[model samples]
Target: MPEYTTGKPWRLSAFPPLLWAVALLLTLSLAYAAQSGATYILIDDNLDTELAPPYALLQEGKALDYRSTTRVDRLMNGLPRNALRPGLQPLVGLMALFPPLEAYLLHELLVRLAGLLGMYLLLRRYGLPGPRLAALCAGLALAWAVLPAYTAYGVSVLGQPWVALALLNLRRGPGRWSDWLVLVVFAFWSSLVLAGMFVLAAAGLLLLRDTWRHRRIAWRPVLGLLVLGISYGVVEYPLVYSLLVKRQFVPHRLEFDYARLAPGGVGVGLASAGRYLLLGQYHAGLFLRAAPLLAAGLALAYAPAGAARRRLLRKLLAGVGVLVGVALFCGFYPQLIGVVQQTVPPLRAFNLSRFHFLTPLLWFGVLAFSLRHLPGPGLRAALVGLQLLLGLGMNTEWTLNVRRLLGRLPATEPTYAAYVAPELFRRIRQDVEARTGQQPARYRVACLGFAPAVASLNGFYTLDAYQNNYPLAYKHQFRELIAGELARSPELRTYFDAWGNRCYLFSAELGKNFRVAALPERAVAHWAFDARSFRRLGGRYVLSAARLLHPEASNLRLLGEYAAPGAYWHIWLYEVR
Candidate 1:
């Protein structure tokens, strides 16, 4: 019907059975969330860093400020605005148009919807099972949609289905107009460094293989890929310009020592391999707990059916093998990178291990084969159902939201309101201003026992931050405050000196557990700091969630204790004396 598939065209005919199935599943998910409480949002990377910049830009009316001089001064003294993601992205720009909580929820739902639609269409266009097996294809698409991931990444991870469809379809010949449309939209929304660079590399290889095999260049597909690559270049103009034109600062990624950062033995490597192969990567969440069962089922079905099952079974096994290989490679990545870093000095920063991100998409495609040939329809249906349940159950955000809605949320899990209590921070700002006779703009503060992100969100200029990328010179400068602590513990030393993403105030007593709860007994007993160095950086105060045992020893004096009812953090404000 669509040139590639000599089967029925997948259109939503009248009642649309596939659409109903997807809708029912999505409704069940939403109903469960509604019952649980909907105020909660994923905090970890989403609220802390990713959401912060976009929300701040929206507040400041600088969402479109692409000026080189424009900086998100709230982060790392003054992190370049370009250092954050492009705010013009439709999903990201949602923050500018609505309240943060609403924006986050909307973003999450929209991406999932896009993912579902994209995956289902991709499956239909490609020769997957058949358009007739509505439930199986719809189920597969639904599973891919509700993955445990951050919406801050937009559709980059979930949008893989659309990306593959566009490329592969184009490679076959001149694909539909929708395929080209999909890629243009994808390029604008996707992250070049995270997924696009890898996509481009894969496309390059695909082109080479095609040329070698066909003995002729496939110009249409080549042009399609080039358009996608160029679109990425256009959208990520700031990032591209920084790389090519003017790099005022060195990226902290350059100093990454993977050997020290990720250390493990062969057993650990094998265990990691198992997780990656079966369970999937954490960021690109796919709980393929049912994958083993699927494999067993496929093998059993193939054992009885001779020649008919051979092609499908072999392809499935090969995909499994490739995924296992990827997992093993990921496990031993540090060792491999260590060798490469020494040989190719400049390429040290590039994280090639991200190829593992492709596993979920490949694995799902393998499942498409299994669905068609999996003997019994009842058994096939059960497999899809189990996969759905695993994905939903394991999803942290949904689970937490449900718990919060039911009022069974643990003290550890703060709701979105509790996490970013702007009123609490507003009070802190007022108290500090009244006490010091200086605005937050005049002074920089550091956080102990909690993330510096808390201070950053509250309009406080913070000295320490959880920046993924920043100037390496700043990292060296910040190390002065924690050099003694790093000397005390090798673990902390390796954590900061080698990895160093969270360039925050480190302590041996704290031991990298930044989320320090406010309890009477909880305090940093062995607190130490280079006060003069902190002062030189213009850090005037320490906004800690835990009290310092001997404040004077670290050249700090108690200013005030601040807290709001039902909030996560109880601040023990201190001045650098």
Candidate 2:
């Protein structure tokens, strides 16, 4: 044996068989419990477009707006919208482009298996005692449940942890070409943009390196440095290519709105909003609260001196560099900030603060690594316990004050809430099928809350809801309906007419609430018929095309109500012939 200088002969090697057995038992138990919770969520919430990019990609393929490159169509076109722009980034979409069955298997592998493997690699790289590493990782997964985004999506989304661990390894390496290759792949795979910023910082620091003395410089870190060049290349090359060569998608609309730099404005350029996502609040706030400890860690790692100091210091520097880089880029990058402000909500609709997701992880990781090399177990434990207590206490006080001021809800209930109306949709689909002898399978519907849900599960298109294609919808390309410019275009009017003619019509008041002012008043009135002509179907209500004299529907009928008792509101269905 090399030495038993460490504790308990590295528990993993000591009791491999026993450890595997225990792991199996715990995993099975956890899987069973998760399956139970999985029952309450809808198909969209299950493994679909609201999250997992792979599923989103698959949905994009099913929709076939493949050539529709603009942002509006990108969300609305739905298939793996990211698949439309094939390459290394949007790695989730790239994975999705594989054969469906294989894509699913690979996606499962990446999101779930890779995450576990990533954690294992991290522990191994850090030279943690196997048992201690296992304990730490298990505690993290269970208590903190660090993979909340993955859990929410019902997909692993392992890219974040995978990148974190890989970058951590790259920090202390002059390894084989394969190591560098893996780092490159990891860099390309970060869709969260946090990873991209980290890769950039890592590369930048490498550029500033003059020499690696006691330890010879390796090619892996150098290879990994390529990621920084790649990022600049990605943005600059496209614009240059458009301008010089083909002029593909240009006027080169590189927007620069510095007002976003103002405290509250949502403009894109040089704004706090973008930076806030990566840097998060702590760093973004006055004094760069995390900076000193970050500086201390860097000082220990880089300040010339002792060999013992250097080894540990190097690791700290590399890790801290990655953390700081991620923070700075996320704080600085305007487009990314705007993206979060646009796509995710409560973050968007309410606070317009998109950075909260990555912020917690950044601080937590920094805190963990900063304390990693404390002298002894007892001392380390005390130091960690103190930090945790202090940090948690501070956060609690901050949260309480913020809650008192802003009246925020506790984490359990989502703020800016939308209802779960799965039963309502199922009823609509069923009744439409029964009355018209045609299922709602072939055509799309236009209800607010249930359109994406319907399109995802029922495999139909929805006019009112856009998937990942926010550019078109948000930019108002579908302006004819939203701005009451319905009279302006024959094509837009035709689309409205066809939508109205569908056998399925979800109720209007419900439609109005869901649309959030996108739908033209005329579109709702023309398609939904009138409040006066429809009859109530007991718990459900419907309007018939027969009641309203229109060129489209002359003979329509009321459908039986499809709603959970006590949950009835606006989402009723009507069958028009």
TM-score top scorer:
1
Tens-place lDDT digits, model 2, residues 70-143: 22222233222322222334333534566332343344334444444554455445634454545444332221
The best candidate in terms of lDDT = 1
1-577 in candidate 1: lDDT tens per residue?
Answer: 1233557455545445557656865785573344212366666666766766676667566777888888876677777778777766875678777866677777778788888888888877773546567666787788778777565687878888888888888888788898788888988877788788877887688689889998999887788888898888788888888888998568888888887776777887788778877787777775765754564466556556776567656776676777778889987888778778877866656788887767777777766756656666677677777777787787888887678667787777677667666777888889888877888889899888777766766778888887787878889999998888898889999888887888888888878677676544368787768888999888898888887889899999998887777677788888989
Query: Candidate 1 at residue 442, lDDT?
Result: 90
Worst 10 residues of 2 by lDDT: 31-40
For model 2, state the Cα shift of residue 232 in Å. 14
Q: Can you tell me which runs of candidate 1 are displaced by over 4 Å?
A: 1-14, 25-38, 60-62, 127-131, 292-296, 299-305
Scored against the true structure, residue 542 in model 1 reaches a CA lDDT of 88
Model 1 residue 251 lDDT score:
80
Each prediction's whole-model lDDT (CA): 0.76, 0.38
For model 1, give the 10-residue run with minimal summed lDDT.
Answer: 29-38
